[model samples]
Target: MSSARWIYLDAGRGLAALVVVHHHLMVFFDHEMAALIGDESLLLRAFRGISEWNVTAILFFFFISGWSIFLAVERLGTLNGIGPWRLYLLQRARRILPMFLLSLLWAGGLSWAGERNFNDTSFDVLVGNLLFLDTPASLRGLWFPPFAGNGPLWTLSNEAWYYISLPVFYWAVYSKIANPLVRIDAALLGSFVVGIAAIGVNAILPNPFFLFATLWPLWIAGYVYGTSFGQTPIERRVIFWLGLMALVTWSMALEIRSDTLRILSDGCILALCVVLLVKIVRWQTQLTRLHYIDGIVRLFGSVGRGSYTIYVLHYPLLLFLASSRTELGGLATSLLGMGMLIAIAPHLETRIYAHVNQWFALDRPRADA
Candidate 1:
């Protein structure tokens, strides 16, 4: 949480937030936009890559999350006992659960009131979402969610699991166990076996392992970067960035297999992120200013702070807009949802943070710290 790192992360978060918001908004316009302005237009061509990769920014969020969670856990002090884990969970519950549950409730209620209802949402799916355990058997489905209301919550649900397990990771992976019979090496070996078993089980009941099995590696990269921040050399990082860029540029020219393209593109993006984040973080003073370019960054950072709120609210807004105004409703809803992120998101975040933290006595820093 150094100033430099915060600025970088905030900037990234802001950009991701903007992309995701517009991506969701533009979904209403997906077919229309292409038809209204034919795909041949220069403007459409210009934004093709960005438009395609809009949701990919979720990877960046995960990358930043890995780093941030590590800092928070480390800041909570040593994992001498279960104390750190308890503090981690408490802080997480205080910071995340209340806002998310409240928002989920808000979205669900609105959806039920409107044309849509969770009549199809099984009890397990409902409780899974309510508990932020969307990976439960009841919640599994075709890729992405079948539920429309608050669809963006999938990422948050993944993150909740990540937060809960981070402390276990730090304790079992890095530190010495109190019992000598099980060392870090043994713990890691056991984990590897467990991972394989999980994957096997996922092959049967895929829902159980989808979130933890697939995404943990990406999250772990963040932890690695955070813990080894100073160890990465400047030359290597710069070289890696340049190499990645060149490779990407070259790869785009060639038509590769779908699986290859996905893995290479996503893997490289995640790898580049790790390099960029771990490099020496220099504070961008101009980022905080109100000048035109700098102001844009600041605005992104501002919106980034409330990105989650914006995310949750957008789903309901989309539904409401679609249901209420069939004619140009998408356009109207898009603008209104984006505008609300700017005008009301901050206030909502502040009030919710205060009320929830106070009620749960989570306003203070970790007691371990």
Candidate 2:
């Protein structure tokens, strides 16, 4: 992919993060916002409509994550053995865990300072969150809510499982079992056992396994797209058909009452979005050089690099500000919260992660080494 395409991808991700931020701001201060801007105001109505895009934004995150992970694994070469898999896990952990743990601490501190009893912060919940067992309660299973009301943590659990699954999937696909039929049977049987186990787990313990299983295909779609990106020439007609299908699925998602079917529809929508994003990047690459557009894309790229920090930390900060009973208007408070998050995100995500990586020697090995 061209550098321009990479920048555009980053811009897309950054824009998605901003969408999530806007949605949460709208939700967190809905009453205050109604008071500030009259309840019937067009602006307020528009904000509410925009807030509904949070789900799509999150799905975008999932698609990009899969694409990035595919690139990461390819860059690392084959995970043919246990050592490579361990290293991959370590690297992923280094990138993800520090900020995640810090966010938990931040949320806990905010809850304590605010004296808010709204969230479950007990030891079991903390452990569950740390273990990435926090899933939506609608999944028909025992589930742990996000600790201290950090609702976004649910996506992190899904992300972590996807990370872990990629290596396993790679290993299985590239395994030494040479017989194709035997391999197929093994894969199917293993899947069957896992499904049964997941059913049992849902009946017993807090189960995030099932939720991840449901969304796993969306990630796989992205990985497939990434692998075929430059090699395959996609026609505009194909994209149109995919978009049409996405629309149909999305409408079905809205009209259906079944949670599982709705999730499947959302997955289809996200998979289609991945294809659209690729087309968008290609289109951007063909455009004439526009300095203003380039500058804007670069700014968003920077934000995208820090997007994880924004996702994990924004809610706690917003909650804290909201709970403080400050004299600032809702708009001012929301802007302040966003500003603080943007300012701090790059430092926490890049600088702090770099420092932690070096301190722990978790950096990927040099190709020369």
Candidate 3:
């Protein structure tokens, strides 16, 4: 992918992260916000509308994950050798685990300070989260909930599985196909097959991990798009078709009575949105360069680089503030939280991760070889 395309993706990711954060902030402080700004205020109505996009923002994150992982594997030639596989796994762990552990500790400290039971903070729960076994409350007996009620961590489990499954997906589906088009087709077919199988198994056995398999196709859609990047032109007809599908599935999702069907329809909508977003970005980049637009994108791109830290740490901090009975107003509290995120994210997400990578010599040339 071109640097311009990357800049666009980063901007999207950053904006999505902010949306998610804002949604949670509104949710956690709804009473305070209503008391301060009146529930009927136009500003509150707009905030509610923006907050409703959180689910779509999350699905976008999954799409970006697939695209990023595909690019990383391709650059490292991971599929061609065992050495690259080892390095890839280490790199992924380095990127995710340290900050994840830190987030858990942060949550634990908050729970202790507040004397509030956000959720179970037991040893087993901690271990389960570390193993990426976090799942929805509907699957409580089958898997762990996010540690200390940091609900967003559930997606990390899904993403971790996606990372682990990618190499296996390539070996099983992409290795035998010499033609690029055929490989893409086969991968998509495989994703659908696996998704269907997972849904069937979950229906019978009710496993938490099966949710990962059920949503695998969304990730695959992003990977396929990345592989075909720049080669495919943004066509209006393609966008129209995808938009139609998204609309249909979104309508179905709203009306569907069955939880399983509703979830499936929502997934379909998300996958279509991912495709539509890619086309939109491509079309946007094709337009004549505008300095102001480029500057805005670059600003978002900088935020995107620290998005992981912002995501993992925001909830615990919010919980702490909410429990502390601070004198700050709702807007002030929200602004303070965002300010903290801005100040802390760079150090934790990038500088600390890089420092750990250096300490362990994980980025050494010999390690890559």
Index of the highest-TM-score prediction: 3
Q: Could you give candidate 2's per-residue lDDT for residues 254-327 as a string of tens digits?
A: 76554644655676666676677656756776785557877888888788867888888888878877767667
Which residue pairs in candidate 2 collide? none
- Give the winner by TM-score: 1 or 3: 3
Model 1, residue 315: distance off in Å is: 1.9
lDDT, model 2: 0.69
Residue 176 Cα positional deviation in candidate 1, in Å, after optimal superposition: 3.5
Which candidate wins on lDDT? 3
* Residue range 192-277, candidate 3, lDDT tens digits: 66765676677677777787777777777677667766655323333343355456546755764445445555655776766766
Over the full model, what C-alpha lDDT does candidate 1 score relative to the true structure? 0.58
| TM-score result, candidate 2 | 0.82
Error of 3 at 257 (Å): 3.3
Q: Listing every candidate in turn, what is its Cα RMSD in Å to the true structure after a full C-alpha superposition? A: 6.4, 5.2, 3.8
